[model samples]
Target: MASKYRRGFDITRDSLRVFTREPSLILLPVLSLLAVGSAFAVLTAIVFQQGLVESLVTNDLYQYGALFCAIAISSSVATFFNAAVVHCAAQLFDGNPTSVRDGLAAAWRARRQIAVWAVVAATLGTVLYILDEKFGVVGSLTRAVFNLAWALLTFFIVPVIVLDERRSLRRQLRRSGSLFRDTWGESVSATLGVSFVFLLVALPGVALGAVGFFVLDGILATGALVSGGVIIVAAIVGSQTASAIVRTALYRYATTGEGVGPFENRDPDTVFPES
Candidate 1:
């Protein structure tokens, strides 16, 4: 059994490993671009929803409720696609020998599970948003920590659903969650660490977008538009690459005994049942 508490690995180190081991993982970068683009579209929809709700909810309470519901549905769909992309990237980077079409196909195959997970994640976020608005909970450190912990804890769920074809939804989630629990610190460190680097690389683009906005007097200037667009694309690509790395790490740990604990104890016979 995987000891679950294995250490000495993280996202940054894992990413470094991938880059060094297989620099030809071009699909990761492409997946990142696609994921980020989809995210941008989803964000735009949410923003538009708030504006629409404000404009249309002057007298009708039901209209406001309906708008919010629509936004939630749209957000969930975007999240499902994003999760799918992450799974695809992970499989590709892990030497799964798949294409973008394979990634999409994987998502389609696991659509139900992905959709369920999306709704759950979005509902959590929405609840936090509600609390922030209704009870002035925005500054609560506990809330912040809760959100952070939840995000990291469930990081492996989608990838598990996408990559583990032999298992059903319940088993896949349970197994992934268990694997993650055993490797919690490592997972968090790697995920957050890589995300930080991505943010650092993206910061300059954000600054340029800000300059564009100001230079254009709050209107979208050419520079701002270009900068923002580039930043978004970079974010997407980075995300996809990161997903591939995480998937590789988990799958390896699960099947090949790459990490600490249960990973090492994996039955070689079970690891490659077909071989």
Candidate 2:
């Protein structure tokens, strides 16, 4: 267990190293956020114009439908940018110069595959959301478990979609699952370390927000709130970018028995022992 934690921390550190080497990688997540925000804004406008918002608020079925549509669209937009990030990460791993434009172009080339995967992911997410909303404690627990499982299973979907676009969506998902199962230990470790890092990153924002709520007033309080929001957003974007880099490295190591950049010293067999 200690070894697993240590390994995860190492992976997380290396991921950060990769990001620092190419600070522009952060742009991918920022772009993703903007794209998703725009999509949500458009969807919200349409929903309100059509009076679907009222139905969504009053009717459970309508709410679910609206939520599903939102999830589908947001997931597609996120996946598109995520694919780009993975492409950039791969390039970084290969010691090649890459920019946000390069990543976006790569993702654009795989837009159709991303759309298919997004639909599948959104359907599963909606089902889980319904389970959590409609059922009691049991449903909530089931949804939580299933959500984690879904994340684990599809961990490599972005890398696969970006690197192996010829594969069918189902096959891509299967490949992702296979790769994850083989490197579950490293995956869990990397996730644990990343979670810890995010928590630390979020703490300052939380503290500022709490101080503003309890102590500050007037412009000072508003400034605190704004600063806190910025910190939180930066943390989220940095964490996401680091995670994509780590996952891309892991996928490359698992598939090719080779590592790149900070991962160069990591032995594939050690990370994912032959089983």
Candidate 3:
């Protein structure tokens, strides 16, 4: 138990150190959220203002098409910013300084590939949605299995998109899968470490929020709730940034046999071992 906590602490500390060194890294995820939220808002407006709700409900083809568009819009936005984050981390890990602009530029350079990937992901997502919505318990079970497989297979796709040479999406998928097959253990461990650390950070705020919502009253409750919300949001951003850093470092190490940024001076085996 103690060792587990220590490992989490070490991973969290290192990831945070990288973030402190490159504070602009936070902007990528923030931009992703804003863009995705806007896309969702537009879709909602179209549904309500344009009277697509009934069409969306009754027409299978139209409903699927709309869902596909919604998924593609949100997924593409998120993926593009993720590519930006990966690109920035790539530079940072290489001992070069970077900015939000540089990261955005890198992602833009790969815009076509990212769009193709978004379409691929959205198609699969739509099929899964249809399955779960139309097929009952068997569809739910199949969706769960397929979703897990999809996540594992595409684990390194963002960094691969940013860093790999222009290749077909199938090739990129193979590359990601190959890398995962080689480093799955270390990757999973480091991700869990980051998650565990952030969970610890989030718990106090969660408790405070629960208290404010249930056990407290009036201004005291409002203050507690607000405080908790801030803490939780900060924790979320921190975790997202930290997780990205970890993924980038692991990708760099797996592909190039070298660590970058926070993993620079430490033995890769100490944190992210080769298996």
- Candidate with maximal lDDT: 3
Q: CA lDDT of each candidate? A: 0.56, 0.82, 0.84
Models 1 onward score TM values of 0.64, 0.89, 0.87
| Order of the predicted models by TM-score, top scorer first | 2, 3, 1
RMSD after CA superposition, every candidate: 8.3, 3.0, 2.9
Error of 1 at 217 (Å): 7.4
Question: Can you give the lDDT of residue 131 in candidate 2?
Answer: 85
lDDT of 3 by residue, 133-171 (tens): 999999999999999999889888888888988479999
lDDT of candidate 2 over 1-275, digit per residue (tens): 55655565676678778867678778889988888888889888988899787788899888878778888898898889888888988988888899889999999999889889888888888898888887889889999999889898898888889997456987998999999998887776666677777777788998998888889999999989889888888888777877888788888878886777446887644653323
What is the per-residue lDDT of model 1 for residues 2-43, given as tens digits with 9 covering 90 to 100?
212122223434554544433444454555455555766775
What TM-score, to 2 decimals, does candidate 3 have?
Answer: 0.87
User: Which one wins on TM-score?
Assistant: 2
How high is the lDDT of residue 199 in model 3? Answer: 88
Candidate 2 ranges beyond 4 A from true positions? 1-10, 268-275
The candidates, ranked best first by lDDT, are: 3, 2, 1
Of candidates 3 and 1, the better by lDDT = 3
CA displacement after TM-score superposition, residue 192 of candidate 3 (Å): 1.4
